[model samples]
Target: MDSELAAASQWATESNAAVFIRLKTESGVVQAMDSEEGDEEENEEGEGADVIEFHPEFTYPIYGEHERIFGYKGLSINLNYAAGSLATYFNIKYTKRIEQMESTSTVALKADDIDTPMRQILADSVCATQSEFAQQVVHDTRVFRPSGRKVHEYAGRSSQTEQLRYEIYSSSFNDTESAKYHERMQAFVLFFIEGAQFIDTSDERWHVYTVFERLDMNGQTSYSLVGFSTVYNFYCWPDRKRARISQFLVLPPFQGQGHGSALYSYIHAMVLGNSDYADLSVEDPSEAFDDMRDRNDMRYLLKHNAFAHIKGARVEQSAISELQHTHKLSRRQMTRCIEMALLKMIKSVKSQEFGEFRLFVKRRIYAQNMDLLQALDPDERKHKVAESFASVVDGYRRVLSLL
Candidate 1:
């Protein structure tokens, strides 16, 4: 669909004319009739007549405006239109690409010249309107072909998806051969995900968690590549036994199946319920990942039943620490979760109400820098406080948006 749309667009541009489409039925008959013709035979024969205009947008943009293309070079700036409104129309699809068809979808009326591969095309994706946002890629049975063969498989002794037919494994660098397939899967993220980076999976401290869908071919059971995440064991400030999640990607097609959450939770649960007692943390999380962490962490924290007792209490550093200890969350993660919960405490955002929350959050951000803050002159201290407060409030807003 992406390529077909692009072709229609390119053809229109080249000919200095408009592009139209004809729909073919199951029996390979083009169906339609033009009212202006006023011929009953034309209507009954199913000869093409209804012509639709063609237009296309980059649902999966692989190129930048400045890149060179046939008959075009540098940016093709179309500033006469609003860019903000186009944002939702072209964000990476939130629905996993694995399951490719949405039964109740209309089509997008756009096209481009870019040649997209079959695997990259979302045949089921609909373009109901030119203004449709990426998140609106309606519900579908998302699936993914990891492109990598199953190198390892293990069952979850206790998990939410225990009855499902699939396997997840935590493998290290020792298996050099299967690691290559894992590497092949990274390419998918390059196109569908923004700011995705590859890491050194060779380090001994690096552990990979992978999920594979079990398939049957020629009467034999095999596993297809699905989704994966990477975690690196980082040394604690004073201890040497802490792990931090580094890179995470659920191939576009494999999303919406809870695979990403399952992968994250399985590893997190291991850190929380491990016998050796190592701490868990995330290195640097993207907005989407952070939202996932917020939901997962909050759920885990709520399990203690102690959370209910302090649901209405002011969130303090001590409470953050207690939740961390109870749920195996890093100090940073617990603080973030608390900030999200604190937002729920807003009875109103009137002057005093909002200021108290601001002071509370800034108090935490400035706690470690108090010595530096104290050494400053009075004016400088006030300036620093104002700046710090503003910064924390901005971040709090972003978290709230995610929540």
Candidate 2:
């Protein structure tokens, strides 16, 4: 009896492993549609179409912490989307399903119903049938324009050293037409971003910034969705607004090609250019985003005449306040950028200038954690502060190297 139970338990499959996600262009959908009436079953990448495949980074939100589906052998879930408009088709395949009523002189073993959770996750935006999905993909891709007015355009670096044109568009959530399409694309946030939730589109203050690749092929032009950022406008005390970036994501296929930097730069410029916004902030940034933000902010500050002599100077409150007013940055971020600038000025870590810079950073770290340090003895507190200062310096070095 124990041996039989052990054998049945071996059939559990990891949910992340069993799931496959693909982004297909209109040409790929046309190829699939032309083959047969219901030809979306196969999971192969068809020729002459740009089909990108990637897996979910985290599935604990959809599945349990174990992220395992039991009582199934060779379970596969396929999620296909139209790369432009993000129309979705979901399907599941399994080689063998365990019998729920097996008589092993014990309770019956049951298999997890994978479709129920997925249906809820996809929401009403997913098509009910594969044929319906095909028709929707064709129609949506043909008419799909990014949900906003084009605000900026720049060039991207591809692996082949080709300079590709990219455009950034801005839209508000109050636009009903764009909000409907944003609903279809929202599922990607759950798949790619950890601890991310769907936004409430009813609020008129929400805005979306999207990045798309401008593809011109055979005398026809099309735009493919690359990544996007969501920002919310918060009311300031004195008839002003504060902009906070809630979520930002760049698809895995186009991640390392400098697209994200371009998108962030555009948003940063837009926020600063608008006189109505008092400042700009981020809701909850991941470590990767923090590093990217640091590099970009430092780069921008370096271009200003006021920031030219900021290196190795005391990070005074007046200086911070003045820069914050002009740049619309939070005090904490402004302080960190100043530290980065100071570090960049030091010619060598072994020099006297590096010691002054290290002490400057230590002062800020100690002040930030003063409450906690008050409880510890003097030597222990000093040691802890030193550790924190070293970590901050290391982080600064990493960001500066990237710049």
* Best prediction by lDDT: 2
- lDDT on C-alpha atoms for all candidate structures: 0.50, 0.81
| 1-403: candidate 2 lDDT, tens digit per residue | 7876777777788998888888877777667667665554654445444677788886777877788888788788888887877788898888898886454657667888888887777757787666777677677656677877899998754444234579998888777767877887777788788889989998899999989887665554566789998999999988999999999999888898888889888888998999999888988899899998898888888777547646555667788899988988877888898888888788998988888888888888989999999899999999999999889989999999987
Model 2: lowest-lDDT 10 consecutive positions: 155-164
- Candidate 1 residue-wise lDDT, 133-162, digit = tens: 212212111222333334444442233433
What stretches of model 2 exceed 4 Å from their correct place?
Answer: 1-5, 33-40, 44-49, 101-107, 156-164
Question: Could you say which candidate leads in TM-score?
Answer: 2
Worst 10 residues of 1 by lDDT: 78-87
Q: Count the backbone clashes (under 3 Å) in each candidate.
A: 15, 0
Q: After superposition, how far is residue 107 of candidate 2 from its true place, in Å?
A: 4.7
What is the Cα-based lDDT of residue 182 in candidate 2?
A: 83
